[model samples]
Target: MRYFIHLAYDGTAYSGWQVQPGVPTVQEALNTALSNVLRQSVRTQGSGRTDAGVHASHQVAHFEADFPPEMTLDLLRYRLNRALPPDVQVFRIHEVDERANARFSAEARTYEYFVRLRPDPFRRDQALYLDRGRPDVGAMNVAASYLVGQFDFTAFSKVKGAETHYICCLYEAGWHETAEGLVFRIRANRFVRGMVRLVVGTLLDVGRGKLTPLEFQQVLHRQQRIAASGAAPAKGLYLSRVEYPAGIVPAADVREPA
Candidate 1:
């Protein structure tokens, strides 16, 4: 049967979501734990990859498994969580249609970038420190507004990306003030490689008076990679959510009794 696994991870300790040679990764940890618990070789596929040092609050992966008749989904989740490391967690496991996929079935993805105006020891690994000065939130929002609607985001994507095209539709994009600092949230139909970090980096330019809002819009229209500023630190970003169509999977719950 096909199953969807809802999970999250703190990416500070691992490479990226995908498995790699020698380097530790979230996928490698998950595959190993699943294999150990199932008592059989198991390979799971993720919804998408988050770069090294990036975090995910919600991620989904799908796999096919044949459990012993006595095993329940809740029991399987508990066992899998026990086998996984502390930094990684499995929140829910349930059966899904064989056609549902963690990646292609997703309708939208949202990412957030955090910046701190003052230093805080606890948030050092989770937010970027910008003690220089508070950025111009007004200017940043003006620049970010251009991101809404469809645009060929070639200017913001990695030059060597494997994607066939650079077109993406943005449902929403904006920066807002938070009690601790500022948060940038963007939701899109799809994203290109290094797209979020790069966008955050360049938008900071506008925030810091380096680029005017109009200039920022012009630069995006130019669609040249070098026209943007350097990419932001990976630690400041998070894959906050992945949305799917209704009935894609069962409703969310803490867990079922085994």
Candidate 2:
């Protein structure tokens, strides 16, 4: 049977979501935990890749397994958590259509980057601390506003990325203040490798008055990777949400932006 897992992980300890020959990874950890509980080898395909040190509050993966007699999903979740590393967790597991895929079936994905104004010991690993004068959130929002709608985001993507094309349809992108700090949230149909970090870096430049909002737009339209600023630190980024079609997941499982 095919099953979908709703999981989250602190990527601080992982090389990335995918497995590597010698490095530890979230996929390897999850596969091992599942195999141990099921008494057979099990593998999962995740919604997408997250670079090293990038966290995920909501991630989905699909795996095929022959659930043994008397096996319950709740029990399986409990056991998987026990077997998995402390930083990784399985929140929900449900049967999925045999054809449903965690990655290909996804309709949209949302990511958030957190910036803390002051140093906080507890969140040192999870946020970017800006020691300089506060950035102009108003200017940043103006720059971010340009991100909504379909565009070729080659400027924000990795130069050597494996994606065939750089076109993406963004539904929203904006920055707002939060209790923890300031956050930038962006939702898009899909994102190329390293896109969010690169975009965040450029937006921060705009916020700091290093680039005008129009210049930011021009950089994106220029389509030259060199025209953009460096990628922001991965520690501040999170794969906050993923949404799928109704046929792939129950209606309650899918989300709409506020």
Candidate 3:
């Protein structure tokens, strides 16, 4: 049977979501823990890859397992959590159709980057501290508006040979001031490597008066990586959500008895 695992992880201790050689990674840990609990080799495909030190609030992965009819998803979820490390967690599991892929089936993804104007020792690892001066929130929003439609994002992506097309349909893009900090949220049908971080960094530049909103739009049209600002720190970015079509998996309220 095929199962979809709902999970979240603190990226501080691991290299990234994907498996890497000779290093700790979220995928490696989850694979090992699932294998240990199932007593068989288990490999999973995540919805997407997050760079080192990037966190995820709601990520999904799918794996196939052949289990006795007596076994249940609740038992599997409980066992997987117990075997996994404290930083990595499996919250729920649902049996899905064989054709429901965790990555390719996703409809949209949302990401947020957090920034704090005041220095806070507690949030050093979760948010970026910008003490230079307050950025013009209005201008940043204006710049973000320019990114709300489809365009070539080569200026923001980090990988070169891996992508065949640079076009992405950005559904929403904007920044807002929260009580705790400044937050930038963007939703898109897809993203390229390092896309969100670079977008945030460049928007910060607009806030700081380094780049005008018009200049930012020009950068997008140029389709050159060097035309954009450097990517923001990985620690400040989070994969906040992933959306799929209705009926792709069982409803959240549906659960097997524990």
Candidate 4:
């Protein structure tokens, strides 16, 4: 049977999601844990790749397994978590359609970048500390608005390999003040590698008065990576959510495994 695994991980300790020879990764850790519990080899395909040092509050992957009639989803979840490291967790397991894919079936994904204005020892690893001064939040928002519609994100993407297209439909883009600091949340149909970080960095430039909103829009139109600011640090970014069509996961299996 094919199952969807809902998980979260702190990417600080690993080399990102994909497995690499001689290097630790979230996928390798999960594969080992699942294989140990199932007593068979199990491999998972994740929703997307996250760069090193990025965190995920919610992520999904799919794997196939044959189970004896006695096995339960809750039991599987418990065993998987116990076998996995503390930084990675398995929270829910649902029996999905044979054709449902964790990546392609996803309708949208949301990411958030955290920024801390004041020194806080507790959130050092989770948020980016800006010491220059509080950025112009209003200007940042204006810059963010330019990214709300569908556009080719070639200027912001890191071109590692050939891609079919650079188009992405952004549904939401905005920054909001939080008690801890400020948070920038962006939701899109899909994101190319390094897109968010680069966008965030450029917006930060706008907030700092280094780039005007018009220049930011011009960068997008230019379709050149050099025109954008450097990528924001990965530690401040998190894959906050992923949404799928209603039919992808059955209604009865929607809730977290008990």
Candidate 5:
């Protein structure tokens, strides 16, 4: 049976989400645990890759297991969790169709970069403390508005594979401020490598008055990475959610049991 696993993890102390040759990775750890539990080699495909030190609140992956017809979702989740590392947790599992793919089938993916003006021990790893002078939230929002809609995001991504184009549809992009910090929310049909980090960095520059909002639009139009903002640290970025088509998988399979 093919099982879809919904999980979340603190990406500290690991290379990234994809399996690497020697360095530890979330996919490697998951494949190891699943392989151990099933007593056979198992591989998984993640919804998307998150960089080192990134975090995910809702990441998805699918794996195949050939078991005696007696396997239950509960049993698989239990065994996988028991064998997996503490930093990564499998929240739930659902039996999915053999044709389902965690990444290709995704409709939308959302990410957030959290920046706090003050230090908080509880959120140190999960958030970035950017006390580099209070930024102008209004200016940041204005610049973020330019990020909405389809555009050549070549200026944002770092690693551009031949198969992956830098053109992505930005469904929603904005910044919100709270008492403690600011959050940059971005939802897109797809993302290019280092897209979010670079966007955050440019927005920060806008807030700091280093870049004007109109100039930010010009940067997007320039279609050059060197023309735009800095890529922020990976720690502040989180894969907040992923959207899939209805009936692709049962809703119960998308999250962990309370």
Candidate 6:
């Protein structure tokens, strides 16, 4: 049977979500633990591949197992956590349909990038610190509004393979200030590599008076990644949530925001 696992991780130590031959990755760790628990070579798939130093509040993965039939849900979770490194944790697991996919089956993904104006000891790894003067939050919001629709995000993504189109439906994107920091939340049907970081970086330029909201729109229309400023630090980006169809069995729901 197929199983889905809800997970969260501190990406500070991982290369990313996908498994690479020599690099330590979240997927690799999970596979190793699952394989060890099932007493067979178990493989899994993740919802998305986040960049190095990026974190996730809610990430999901799927695996298939048929050997060592004695394994139970509680036992698998316990053994997996004990076998996996401290940086990654699996909170819940349930048997899912064979058709479930961690990536293709997802309906929406939400990400948040945080920027802080003050020193935060508790959030050093989760938020970006800007020592400069205050940013124009109003202007930044106006610029973010222009990105809320189906559009080609080539201007905001690293130039990747052309096999798939760069178009995506951005449901929500905006900036807000809190005592903790400036929170930038973006929800979309899909995302291109480096898309979120680039959007946040360029919007920061708008907040700092370097780019007008109209100019930001022009950048999007240009369809060139180099037209944008730069990608924000990977440390501040988080996969906050992933929404799936109602009947599908949900994972642990740990680390992911509601």
Instruction: Superpose all Cα atoms of candidate 3 onto the true structure and report the RMSD in Å to 1 decimal.
Output: 3.1
Pairs that collide, model 5: none
- Encode model 6's per-residue lDDT on 1-258: one tens digit a residue: 988888889898899898999998888998998888788999988998988889988899988888466778888899889998988898888887899898888999999998889988887888899989788999999999999999999999887644288999999999978877689999999999889999999999999999999999999999987899988898899998888887675443423454
Q: Which candidate achieves the best lDDT against the true structure?
A: 2
Q: List candidate 1 segments past 4 Å from native.
A: 253-258
Cα lDDT for residue 174, candidate 4:
92
Question: Can you give the TM-score per candidate against the true fold?
Answer: 0.96, 0.97, 0.95, 0.95, 0.94, 0.94
Candidate 6 clash pair list: 57-255, 57-256, 58-256
Q: Which residue ranges in model 5 land beyond 4 Å of their true spot?
A: 159-163, 253-258
Best by TM-score, which number? 2
**Which 10-residue window of candidate 3 scores lowest in summed lDDT?**
249-258
Off by over 4 Å in 4: 250-258
61-165, model 4: which lDDT tens digit per residue?
Answer: 999999767779999999889999999998889888999999999999999999999989987878899999999999999889999999999999997735688
Cα distance off (Å), candidate 3, residue 5: 0.5
**Candidate 2 local lDDT, residue 105:** 92
Report the Cα lDDT for candidate 6. Answer: 0.88
Report lDDT (Cα) of residue 111, candidate 1. Answer: 90
Better of 4 and 5 by lDDT: 4
Regions more than 4 Å wrong, model 2: 251-258
Residue 25, candidate 3: Cα error in Å is 0.8
What clash count does candidate 4 reach? 0
Candidate RMSDs in Å, in order, are 3.1, 1.3, 3.1, 2.4, 2.2, 1.9
Report the C-alpha lDDT of model 5 over 157-191, residue by residue, as the tens digit.
78555435689999999988878788889999999
lDDT of 6 at 5: 89
Report residue 166 deviation for candidate 5 (angstroms). 1.2
| Cα lDDT computed for each candidate against the true fold | 0.90, 0.93, 0.89, 0.90, 0.86, 0.88
